[model samples]
Target: MEEKRQTALVTGASSGIGRETAIKLAGKGFQVIAAARRMERLEELARQVQGILPRRVDLSDIEDREKFCQYLSDLPEPVSVLVNNAGYSIRGAIEDVSLNDAKRLFEVNLFGLIRVTQACLPGMRALRFGTIVNISSMAGKFAFPMSGVYAASKYAVEAVSDALRIEVRPFGIRVVAIRPGFIATEFNDVGNEMTGDLLARTDPDYKPVYQASGAGVGKMFVNATVPGPELIADIILEAVMSDAPKTAYSAGFMSKVFLEQRATLDDDAFDRFLTETTGLTDLKV
Candidate 1:
């Protein structure tokens, strides 16, 4: 029997996990809407995969995001699957990141996700069956040195996912959180660029702290085998395609090791472990 064509929306679909997931979903006979700030890339992806509808929207902008959400709400076919994957990271100590910058980060990483979900929820509830996959980072579990801003946003995502999962389950809406760690993507380079030269502008006392943590992180990844976005895209696809997907799935490099440590350790002990792991415990400036 021929099945009804289902629509799937993937935010941040211009690149990395979003891009890959869009391709995979389309290949599985989904009508995929690929949304991102980069229209050219989305266009390219549409060319690469037939049946992908390229959409350009800057999720960080309130006017633009609302317009996009309205479009989602008005879709002829309700979005049966949604991947809230648009987010970026800026490296800095909590004291270093400006309030304006932090607010902007949350606007995209947290607020945008929440608003988009809101727009889709009505349609999903009307249908009484849908899947929401939120791409939360492993940082959602614990903070790392100089990553407080990004981690805070993911932490908020974790909280929302937990609450929404139960709230919407009665409606047959499933929410799944995918926590990735250090995947091989332009994500790291983009984060570095967005953060700018951190040590150059930070307080002199923070220089050594940054250097030591950088070195600590560098050393840790020296022998690690970083996987590509396909690994995570595959997980997202599984969650979307499953009859009863798990509430959460962890993948990519360092996800298991770090999340396990965070799960097992108590507060003070975890604090020490994180500081030591990031080479900040012995840092003096």
Candidate 2:
């Protein structure tokens, strides 16, 4: 007997983990709607994949996002599987990032996810079954030097997922947060572009901070392999298909090490650890 097909909506499906997850879900008998700002890439994906349906929407734009949400609400099948994978980052210290830039990041990363979830919840409630896979990051648990703005967004995502899991359990809706660490993707490149020349724009005091943090980050991958998006995409599929999925799962390079330390360390101890690891301990401007 053929397995019943489910409707899955994957945001940011133009590239990286979102694209891979959409493809994998389609292979497993899902009618996958691939949403992204890049209509060309999404259309390309749809052409290559039998079950894929490409849709374009820029999550950071409030008007466009609201339109997308309304479209989701109107879907006939009601998205039982929603992968809120559309988010990007900007690298900078607290003072370096403009308030507008930070707000834009939140608009896409946190607010967009929340809005999409809201759009999908009604159908899930009606069916009494659904899975929401939120693609968080290791940064969500702990901030990295020069990456505070991005980390803050992910932190909010963690909070939402944590609370929503309990709130929606009675309706059989499962919310799973996936924390990926240092995957090989264009996500970092996008962050660099979005952040502009951080060192150039930042105060003189922050030069050393950025250099030290960069050095520390380089040291982290001396002999390690940075897995591709498939690793997390597979995890998302597992969670989506599972009868009982974990509330959270961490994968990719350095995720275990960093997450475990964050879990075990006290605030002061963790602060020291982060500083030392990020080469910020003796950073004196």
RMSD of each: 0.9, 1.2
The segments of candidate 2 whose C-alpha lies over 4 angstroms from its true place after superposition are 1-4
Clashes of each: 0, 0
RMSD of 1: 0.9
Q: Per-residue lDDT for 115-143 in model 2, tens only?
A: 99999999999989999999999999999
lDDT of 2: 0.94
Worst 10 residues of 1 by lDDT: 276-285
TM-score of 1: 0.98
**How much is 34 displaced in model 1, in angstroms?**
0.2
lDDT by residue for model 1 over 175-235, one digit each (tens)? 9999999899889898988889988899998889889999988888887789999999999
